[model samples]
Target: MRMPAAKKVKSLPPADVEAIFARFHEIEPEPKGELDYVNAFTLLVAVVLSAQATDAGVNKATKRLFQLAPSPAAMAALGVEGIEAEIKTIGLFRNKAKNVFALSQQLLERHGGEVPADRGSLEALPGVGRKTANVVLNIWFKQPTIAVDTHLFRVGNRTGLAVADNPLAVEQILLKVVPERFMLHAHHWLILHGRYICKARRPECWRCPIREWCRYEPKTPAPNGA
Candidate 1:
């Protein structure tokens, strides 16, 4: 069946945007990404494996995998078969295994076994796209970048924080609208908010902290017997 087009989100004014982000910061001063990793290399691997997978799923597999191969050299030594076996539970495991191994090799050969801080260098790695690179840069390197994942895209557009058609546009709009103090943690806040509250199918709007600031009409009511 053909789905209805997404509602055109009305843009929030600067003051409203600031207030919304201010609330996010006040509630969770230092929001963090759910994906678990030890260091930059592990973080890269985790993000790569999280393409069509959940953070909890990636963490579940990587708990042992990271212990087995914590470094690029170690992961390279583990080989594609080993990586595949470890991450087989995740979606696109075969390709993700190939990428993990190949990127590990590249890290050793070109980067001296270190994840590069530069966006171009990070994106050059296998399976590391703009989103992955942005995540690594923001989380590991403390860069104020918005990694426009499904959660962030939905939250940004739905709440009028950013009214964009694509992830890239949403990211760009958020970068401009979000205050500098909140930029570093903005993506995480939005991600967690969307994942738990502003859900795709049925957002729990009744108890939302930022409901007053949201542009989404027809706010969902409390579930029966709640």
Candidate 2:
């Protein structure tokens, strides 16, 4: 297989960009994040723990964890040690536990145990960053913000949707190009597509719904041409 192109096309044409998302919407009309959360506060914590971890992994760890402490007050009661014990199965659980505990305290002390809708407020919480805040805002608050993770970064470049050197640049280009109607679920669509189809190694380009508009070169052939 050929190596991924070192250079990236700036972006697809507006029509192609529109069609790409249209295809995504058609394939999965109601795309959703894989993480399980009962409410905005739980969703916020789940996104924070998802750093460098798979959604499935985070979900598994958070299931009982959330059931035990579903709110900020309940989470704060867990303390760092208790939180760590529950999520130890995940990577960097100690640090994640500390962050969760601290953020839970902050939520209680600052926001009265409610998750904030504003980006700055959300990012101010412990363990929360731009990407995490964006995810929370997009998913829980119904904002049109795009959170650029590794998958989105790769897909944006490989598909010529919004190639850039870093996630922030890709996010900016996507914000400007992705249709307003699609912006709400754009990140989820791209993420699921990258995770299941346009993977980093051995992308399933043969069955990609948007292969016609995708600029990824040397598309992977189907097994024995099917």
TM-score winner among the candidates? 1
Residue range 1-226, candidate 2, lDDT tens digits:
1124435665789999999999999888899999999999999999989988999999999999999999999999989999999999999999999999999999999999899999999989888999999999999899999998888888999999988887788899999999999999999999989899988888899899999999988899998847
lDDT of 2: 0.91
Give the alpha-carbon lDDT of every model: 0.91, 0.91
Off by over 4 Å in 2: 1-6
TM-score of each: 0.97, 0.96
Residue 62, model 2, lDDT: 94
Off by over 4 Å in 1: 1-5
lDDT of 1: 0.91
* lDDT tens digits by residue: candidate 1, 4-86: 23578789999999999899888999888898999999999999999989999999999999999999999999999999999
Colliding pairs, model 2: none
Model number with the top lDDT: 1
Going through the candidates in order, what is the number of backbone clashes in each?
Answer: 0, 0
